[model samples]
Target: MGSSARVTEPQPLPWRTTRVVLWGIGLWAVALVVTLAVPALHTGDRSWWPWCCVAGIVLGLLGYSYVRRGRGNASDA
Candidate 1:
């Protein structure tokens, strides 16, 4: 006898992808601002902190553009 089972796919998100990416970029920007404004945050080895935030913002922008072009998702089989 063969077992009977069914598989279900997850639902897609309701929010737009660009909004999510923007939120991440905004957070990174805030972090960069705080890092720059507070001397203690980047006084020594941590001086590279601001760059991390900048990278996040830049990558988020790239992802936003990729999604906007509708090429972010893979083709369904």
Candidate 2:
């Protein structure tokens, strides 16, 4: 007998989506703070890390707003 091949689709829930975004925001916030406090962490390069922090904060806020606006969108599906 041949084994049956089951076709399964993974579900993406609203909480999970929100959690992922929040985690990203949290990580970026931490990195930004660390980079600001510890200049040596950038290996004497002032340009890249600081800019990354700014970008991270901006993108994190954008993602947070998107997540807030899209609450329950996944569960409705």
Candidate 3:
């Protein structure tokens, strides 16, 4: 490595994996309930709420894994 090469150290993350997982689970559950509970949401040719719910759940899970991996790396250092 040259002198100009810079190394960046790990910084603290603001959120936790558990929080993210919980949010994902909650969002998914709520969306599932809404989709299943109300007949209107399930009806029609197109729907957005269900997709949004899926997005939330996926993103939350992704966030959780990302944070967990980051934390592991930080701890190793």
Candidate 4:
């Protein structure tokens, strides 16, 4: 009898995850630049700072999730 071996097939990842990651990075970068330039905006309210920070955090979290997913798949493969 021939030797029995298991063969595993590679699965393709969803494109939505990749798109989210790319968009997340883009948004994060934009937020960073805006935060840095906020002072130059000359707004005395100072409320934009908090909003910008929050946006950055949200984008970062999204990016992290995608990265973690990719890493998990890589490790599994």
Ranking by TM-score: 1, 2, 3, 4
Candidate 4, residue 30: CA error in Å?
1.4
**Displacement of the residue 19 alpha carbon in candidate 4, Å:** 3.7
How many clashes would you count in candidate 4?
0
lDDT tens digits, residue span 1-77, model 3: 45797779877778765775777779797987888688788668646767777788787777677776676345667
The predicted structure with the larger TM-score, 1 or 4, is 1
lDDT of 2 by residue, 1-77 (tens): 59899979986554566677778878888988898788686666575896797798788788778777875355566
What is candidate 4's lDDT per residue for 1-77, written digit by digit as tens? 69799788987666655666667667767766676676754266765774775677686776668676786346566
Question: Model 2 segments beyond 4 Å from truth?
Answer: 1-4, 71-77
lDDT of 2 at 37: 86
Candidates 1 and 2, the one with greater lDDT: 1
* lDDT against the true structure, each candidate: 0.86, 0.77, 0.73, 0.67
Candidate with maximal lDDT: 1
Tens-digit lDDT track of model 1 for 5-72: 87788888887777888899899999999999999888798988988989998998999899878787
Minimum summed lDDT over a 10-residue window in model 2 is located at 68-77
What does the lDDT come to for candidate 1? Answer: 0.86
TM-score of each: 0.83, 0.67, 0.52, 0.38
